[model samples]
Target: MSTESSAATTLTTADLTLVRALQREPRATWTRVGAVVGTDATTAARRWERLHKAGLAWLTAYVTPPTWTVGYVDLACTPDRLLAVGEEVCRWPPVFSVERTTSDHQLFLGIAARCYHAMDTLVTKRLGVIPGVRSVRMAVATHIHREGGGWTVGPDQHEPSRTSLPLPQFWQDGSVRTIVDALGTDGRLSSAELARRCGVGESVVRRVLARLLRNGELAFRCDLAHVAAGWPVIAGYRLDVPADVLDRVAAAVAALPETRLSAAVVGRGNLVVSTWLRNPADTTGYEARLLRTAPGVRVLDRAVTLTMPKRMGRLLDQAGRAVGYQQILPAGGHPVPGG
Candidate 1:
């Protein structure tokens, strides 16, 4: 499809509702989602298929690395080579997110490694040598108050579940990895499909998936291109919050309508936030609102996103459509070919 067509595409309200339903219940059946979204199962499934085919929306599975430390790194690169550097960096196994931002530091990278030492080596030994890179700043995320997995395109329509499922034991067996690998590209795959890909029986695939979800070993995310969602402007913030009020402030900011990511990191600006804005001009006003609601939260730095080359496993074009995806293995883990 043409870039113009992709960028011009806009999601209808019903489409947004479907996306939100999946965000709430990633593994829920179409029948359940349809009931919640005021539609039929067939209609719900069709809408999702349309969104997925258009590259405007997608669902993927993630297995968090138990031994890895995640860091958000900012790279200042030569202006002329910024885009080149971004495209190259996004493909690195350790880097999962790459964005061009409006700041002295032109590129923002999210890196995951087995430990602090690996992260250090990646920054000083690997990233430092990249041509055109001028400087680098790294912040280890101390706590994740809210991840992108928690953000939804629309308001919550379903009531909170009163009962909690029992957490299952964390499993790192090859079978578990195979299951995760099968679902990495599409989290909504059916039991039959998962079984076919993993070379297991349907019942076994079903059991493994259930265990993974119940134990929090796997996370599913429903993502859409911001431009197609009517929120064309993306902004990032670094806030200096007092230690005593950090949790409270993080929670408050996370609850905002525009927040996509909010976390507490170890750095000069301890609180990092990413938000979607309907208009680029509204950035100052949004900051004002944040200040009003979150008292004593100082804005350390802010950057407006120019382009996102990659998000999660999806490689996006300049217009923000998922043209392809790169397989992301767990940190310090080997790839399970064709799993």
Candidate 2:
């Protein structure tokens, strides 16, 4: 067996049960988590702390798309400086996820911005001018059928219910921003801790958090190293579809068990999908399954992720574990130093 698979086996079934319990309720109390996992609160908390400290699992939050403009960028960089270019871009707050992929466009980025104009400026003026960047192709997500935040740790979990809440004026409140930044780094922070960080009363923190969650303004997710989770391969597919069937195609693709992200975009390819697989060979079978399920989808391009340096502002190591954290504010709101 490969080293990754061997490392994966080290996670006991009990450890995964704890992860799944959190996947269902990201901010549940240790008492609650222990109840669901059939262990005591102290043991559950201790085990989670160990996994988190090792960068094997984590919890984080993000402002869901449609609240801000969501876009993807495919960048072709000089082969010699490809890793350098990815490192530079990954530090920016707007670029939430950066992947080194097996394609002519060596880097793929997921970006969020306040508006299309801001996204354009960030790309054309900021990203496009990077020293080693040879070319840029940006696609605006017209619909977010599924996103990484919606994915769960194991099989048999239903998709989280989604509620479309209007953007509230208080979204820009200082306390709210503080809460979001703190939770984005550690979603499991207690209300008292979050209140302390936001310099507000616990009651105030509770009220605001309830409002945000009830309104669907903030999203929390439980994430773990994919390799340790035993799904070692990530494949992305670009698809062309007639506009008439775009939504239908997106729904069909997003419903697949392996899908991590499925979105309709306004670009060369109208549909883009990313999926987890047991092995590289699964990519072929996945495409064939998509063809049978979503006949309207015509696969245009594909790329397999080689390394994910960052995801949703959390820096990851080669094994896809969260090694460091960066706050991802609304795209363009936080300025990068020296930009």
Candidate 3:
């Protein structure tokens, strides 16, 4: 484990290099990463281990259910039960993210479930029953133009490989679910280790992984604590964009330096965007520049995230350091009970 003093230090150039390498290849071998980053395999592995221990960096896998629907929900909560409600909602199996924001709605949730019926049940039956619940407004996502997996902390040292591979038609089998579960917490697991966990051969594991990556059925995200990374302010926005230029507007927003997430959903505010700002006051300037770049884009509502208790399955401290992880498996995929 890294000492508190060492963990408190700012990230070094070598640390950034290693993180960039992992961003390109989330599951690459240490030897391969070392070759690219100009270091020995042992040093590369040790540096990554340190980063993970400090809660500054981590890798997580996301599998999109084939027949599932995705939704972004806003909940209005009574002031007294806000904290309790947020904590409980984060434990739901289908919920991927939960945030406390400064807006009319106190909480924001991202959910994924098997189908429309499943999503309805989750919102109406499960989430609605929570004690502090007031009102729920959900926006079903139509297309995900950009996700956090594509966001990077630094520029790439080398161009990523563009090699194309054949994709599988069906990936909802038990073996695939096993692989996803094993890799969810640790995306750097070796093929042999994954095979052992899945009770399959190494070659079979490799094949399934390749298909998942090629077909866009899975996304691997390299997460960092924003405040620790020197970017303290996290802001979210919903944009009302012209229908014809929606895709163009989303692309422009994703290209911004501060963008952490950008997507198009079905709601009054169709485009949802999240950005990290160097300072809280920079929000106005950033929004101004966005309007200049995308002429017809109108900002509907903006909220600054006051506290994020959980993100991408990892529970975070007040200072944004990862303290532990909570595994939320897909409800309809495989029944791995949450701990």
lDDT agreement with native, every candidate: 0.78, 0.82, 0.75
RMSD of 3: 3.8
Tens-place lDDT per residue, model 2, 174-203, is 777777778888888999999888789999
What's the TM-score of each model vs. the native?
0.91, 0.93, 0.88
lDDT of 1 by residue, 1-339 (tens): 887887889988998888888988888999999999998999999999999988888898776433247789999999888878988887787787888999788888877775788788889988888999999998998766666777777653222211122223444477777887777788899999988988889998978877766665567778888899888898999899989989888877777778877778997599888888899898988888888866777888899999988887688877788777777643464542110
Clashes of each: 0, 0, 0
Alpha-carbon deviation at 292 in model 1, angstroms: 2.2
Higher-scoring candidate on TM-score, 2 or 3: 2
lDDT of 3 at 2: 43
**Which candidate order results from sorting by TM-score in descending order?**
2, 1, 3
Q: Which of the predicted structures, 2 or 3, would earn the higher lDDT when compared with the native?
A: 2
User: Least lDDT summed over 10 consecutive residues: which range in candidate 1?
Assistant: 157-166
**Per-residue lDDT tens digits of candidate 3, residues 177-246?**
7787778877888899999888999998999888878777676767777676766788999899999998
Residue 291's C-alpha lDDT in candidate 1?
83
| Model 1, residue 16: C-alpha shift (Å) | 0.7
Q: Which ten residues in a row have the lowest lDDT in candidate 3?
A: 156-165
lDDT of 1 at 301: 87
